[model samples]
Target: MNVPLRDPNIVMKLSRLGSFHQSKLSFLRSFLKEFKDWDYKRDLFELNEHGYGIAVYSFKKKNRVYSLICFANELDENERSDRVIATKWDAAFTLFDGVPAKQDIERLKNEVPKQEFGRLSFKELTLSRANKSVRIFNHVVESLSKGVQPDRELLDKVGYLYRTTAVYGSGKFGLADRFRIKDRKEIYGPFRLEMMLVYLVRQFTFDQVNHVAKNKNPKKAVKLDPEICRNLGIGNSTGLGMAPFIVNHPTLLNNWISARETSLKKIREIKNISNEEIELFLGCLKKSIKNITSWNTESEYQIKKIKSLLSDLNKFIMYLDKEFNFKQDFAFNEMYLDLEKNYCEECIEYVVSMMMEPFDDIVTPLIQEMSSEEGKYFNIPTERTVAELKAILENKYSEILNIDFSKKENNLNFWFISKNKEEPRLANRFDENGADLEQPLAIARDVKKLYDLLSVSKNSWTIAKFLSTNNELRHVVRRAFIVEKFPYSEIQDNTIGQEIMPIDMLRLKLSFFGALKFDPRSDKWLRICMFQGAPLPEQLKNYDEHWVYN
Candidate 1:
């Protein structure tokens, strides 16, 4: 039996996209799978008693090597901040393309810590900076120095010892442009190098904490248990800087959503399900609930969503355990329909992620398809008639056309780049001073304006002639043509609406990064934990493939 892919109109809405969860196709999980057989090593470790020095970790297979050079620094309590404007952090790092020599290390030590002000060479693939969770870091050090493990309750509450505020790659700063390394077979997936940087950073936290503890008390200090080490992952504090990424990279975003929808469609088409597959699906679903229950957040918006998700998940579990039958034909398809009819969007998406866990064959191949050559779709088809562009807009942007952009609430917010950090920011258009310089991120509003103009123009006029007259809508015109081919390319909602939750955009991107336990601090920024339940680097070889659910 063939099952239709979920409608892009329904799936591309910000709320539904925001409800997405990490699956087998998440870049981090796929990164681990790709590098599992490669050699893993701590190539360099030269830290002082205070854990203020240089460390290096590498993943080498044959002649290729990607080394993560880490520099741990001592920062006073007042110097540490997670905002993008902050200049100092507890640690800074860069993933070197090849192994670094003594001179290279010295060169990076000076610049990596300087962060945005520092210049990096093409040898650097990615640059990032992290601040320690001082309270948690100090508690762990004190506990380990006394020959005791830190409180698991405290560890679980915060989830990581350090939280990176930014991870930069793809020509940001002076890092190597993606064109230089895009052909690498191992890193064909999107953000694989970024994932590597964060995963290695996780190990650095463990090594740094252990090193500091041993130095505090050499006699009684004990190494942190490997189990505890595996439980702690790296944390990230993300802000409005991430929102523009999805809007600016339309083809890349479509590839991601397309891969996901394709995986779901293929899984739903399976007619016969084995007992093992059924057992695996149910087991993962049951075990993953711990992730939701332990999720700590102060934002009432997130709190309410979590409550609804948990409540709906419980109801679905009860139905699955009591009424569902594995013997039924196209069982997953039935399950999906039932989920959409009865559960909330959050629960439906949660179960959608779980469904992929039991079917690696369906998801593994799609991982490579998530990256896009966006340049191929950039040029608008100006040769087509004006009528063609109007029809594409009307069909592809049905819901978007209905939005009343003239209303104050519809045009309430504007997105602009900050002068200080050169990062994306959102503000009220009426109250703020920079609406005139607003970025072209309001796709829905602009598309509606394009439609109104198109409705008044002659149907037979070519797009080239129309664009020659109305050049202001060129960006949306380019997007409209692209969206005609890529259904999930455009977000089917008003981005500048007053009720917009910027964190929803962040969450959409983070979910693809395999982040868990999203803790939104506000509508604009959030904290997330990565690799919390993942295997340690040493255990990568011969590790359980489904360790995420373990």
Candidate 2:
């Protein structure tokens, strides 16, 4: 069968894209899979008993070494917060390009914690920080000091010892530009260093807890169980800050989704599935129930979705067990059809994820397709005629064109960078100031405007000529042509619409990061856990390929 991939329009709906789950194609999982055989070590651990000091951890293979230099500080409980506004964190971390010297650590110790305000040099690859989940951290310390593990239920409820507010890479805060290390085979996967930073931070959390416990009473203290340690992963608090990332990195977004859709297309084309692969896929689908049930969320929105997803999943599993036969050719295709008819978006996407679980031969290659050199597509094809551009807007942005931006609800919000932190923020265009300085995120409205303007222009006029008079829609014009090639690159809805759920954008990016257990705090932000069930760095050499499902 020579099947073209699924249409990007159906796959790129904000809700459908948001329903995505991590697979072997997820960046973090792929990163671990790619770098498993590289060396892992604690190159430096110089923190005091109070955990106020510097530490360096490294993963080296041959001549290359990526070191994570960490600085732990004693913050007043009041000083610790998970908001982007927070200036002080209990800990700050950076992935150095190579092993750092004492002088390098000393300079970084002063600036790294300052975050966005800090000036990082070219030697750094990525920067990030995490505030202690005080309740869990203190409880774990108290329990271990008394020689006991903390309750798994309480620990699982929060899912991590620390929650990172932001993980900055690719030139944010003056870090080494991505051009510096884009070619390194070890990190060709997107967010690999960020994953490594979070992974190492998970280790740091364990080490910090163990250190505090040992200091409290060396004789009575016991180490945290490795099993419990494995269960805990790094937590991340994401907000509207992540939403524009997808909008800005269109080709990157296309690569990620294309990898997923390509995997699905390949799986559907499989003619013969061995009994073992079928068993593995079903096993993962069944075991993943824990991820859903234990998925605690206070958002009534997510709660209802989860309830519906669980119900649909149960129904689909029953149908598979009672009615479906793997002996049939195109069995996975039939299963997918049943899922689409009988399941919620959540359950259908969930099953799609499970279907990929048994096909590494298919999934592994797609993993490499996820990362993109966005700059390659950054320049507009300004030589093209106005007619070609209009056709693209009409075809690719047909749904978007119907939105009447003159309505207050359609033009409800404007995305801007917060003056203080330079982070992304959404504000009312009429009520709040700075709409004049609005970031180029309102593609739907702008593309519609571009279409209206194009209607009056000469069809033979080049984009360069049109842009000379319409520079404001330059961003969306560039995007219209891009969407011609990468249909999944643009969201089909008006992002500034009153009904927009900004977290949907965040969830799309998080899913690609291999994050699990999204806990949305509001329509604008959410908390998620990463690498919760992943192998520890030491065990990466020979680890479970199905760790995400585990």
Candidate 3:
């Protein structure tokens, strides 16, 4: 049986994208899987009694090596701030292209802790800074120093000892330009180096806590149990800066959503399923429920989302247990159709991620396709006629063309880069002073503008001639052609809408990174946990690929 891919109009909605959960294709899981056989080592640990010093961790293969150099510093409680404006953090790190020398470490020691103000050579691939969860870190240290484990309930509530405020890569702050390392086969996967930095950082946190505890009481201190360390992951606080990523990298965005949709389409086409595959699917589905039930969020909006997801999942599980039969042909296809009719977007997308767990053959190739050579689509097809361009916009942007941008509410907000932090920020058009400085991120509004202008254009005129006069809308024209080839390339909603939830945009991007526990602090920023329930570095050689559900 052949099953068609889900329409982009339905699957590309911001609401559906925001509800996306991590699957086997997630970069974090793929990162671990790719480097599972690489040699792991901690070549240096020089922290003082308070865990304020330097450390180093690395993953080495036959010739290629990537090292994470860590710098732990003293941060007074009053000076530590997770907001981007902060100057100091508990620790800062850089993932070097290979192992570093004494001079290289000394050079970064003075600069890494300075973060943005610091200068990094091309050898540093990724840079990041994390602040300690002071309460949790101290509690763990105190408990371990007294020869006891910290309260498991408390540890699970706040999942990490440190939460990174930002992770920067791809040449930001003088790091190595991606062009320099883009050809490395092992690191071809998106954000592979960044994931390595964070995963190694997770290990650093455990080591630092143990170091501090042992220093406090040499006689009674004990190492944190490996099981408990496995439960903890690195947390992160992300802001509107991430919202523009999907808009800026449309091809990358398309590849991510495309991989997922392709997986679902292939899974639905299967004519038969073996008992082992069914058991693995059932096991992952049942265990993933814990991720939802244990989800902790104080935001009323997120609380509502979680409640509906849990509620719908209960109904779906009951249907499977009491009514559905796997013996039927094209069973998953039928189950998916039924889900769309009966479930919320959150529940439906959640199940879509779970459905891929039992099919490694379907997912492995898709992972390679997720990275994009975006420059291939940069040039617009200006030789096409206005009539062809008009039809493309009309078909591809059916919903966007209907939006009334003249409405005050439709033009209520603008996106701009902040002068202080040099990061993406969202602000009100009427209330904020930066409207004139607004970045060209409002693709929906601009696409509508293009469509309106193209309406009166002569159908016989070439797009190159049309652009000679309407050059101001050239960006959207380039995007329109890109979207013509890539269906999931453009977001079909108004990014400048008064009702826009910037968190929704952030959530969409983070979901692709395998982040969990989306606890929104506001409409502009949120906190999430990554690498939770993932295997430790030493165990990566022989670990369960299904650890995400565990």
Better candidate by lDDT, 2 or 3: 3
State the lDDT of candidate 2 residue by residue for 1-550, as single tens digits: 5557877667888888788887778878888888898899998888787777888888889999989988898999878777788889999999998889889988898899898888999999899988888889999999999998889999989989988888889888889998988888778788888988988888988888999998987999998998899899988888888899899888888888888888888888887789998999999988888889999899998898889888988888888899899979888887887787877788888888889988988988777677887777878988999999888887888777888999999999999999886679999888988999988898888888999999999999999999999998888887887888887888888889888889889888888899878888888888899989888888999898987767
User: Global lDDT of each model?
Assistant: 0.93, 0.87, 0.92
lDDT of 3 at 448: 88
The digit string of per-residue lDDT tens for model 3 on 1-550 reads 7798898888887888889888888889899999999999999999899999999999999999999999999988899998877899999999998889999999999989999999999999999999999999999999999999999899899899999988999999999999999998888789988999999999999999999999999999999999899999999998988888899899999999899999999999998888888899888888888998888889999999999999999889889889998878989999999999999999999999999999999998998888999999999887899999999998999988889999999999999999998789888888879899999999999998999899999999998999999999999999999999899998888899987888888888888899877999988888899898889989999999999888
Q: Provide C-alpha RMSD values for all models, in order.
A: 1.1, 1.6, 1.2
lDDT of 3 at 57: 97
| Candidate 2 vs. true structure, TM-score | 0.97
In angstroms, the error of model 3 at 179 is 1.8
The residue-level lDDT of candidate 1 at 167 comes to: 91
Which scores greater on lDDT, model 1 or model 3? 1
Q: Evaluate model 3: give its lDDT.
A: 0.92
lDDT of 1 at 61: 99
**Candidate 1 local lDDT, 50-124, one digit each (tens):** 999999999999999999999999899889888888999999999999999999999999999998899999999
**Candidate achieving higher TM-score, 2 or 3:** 3
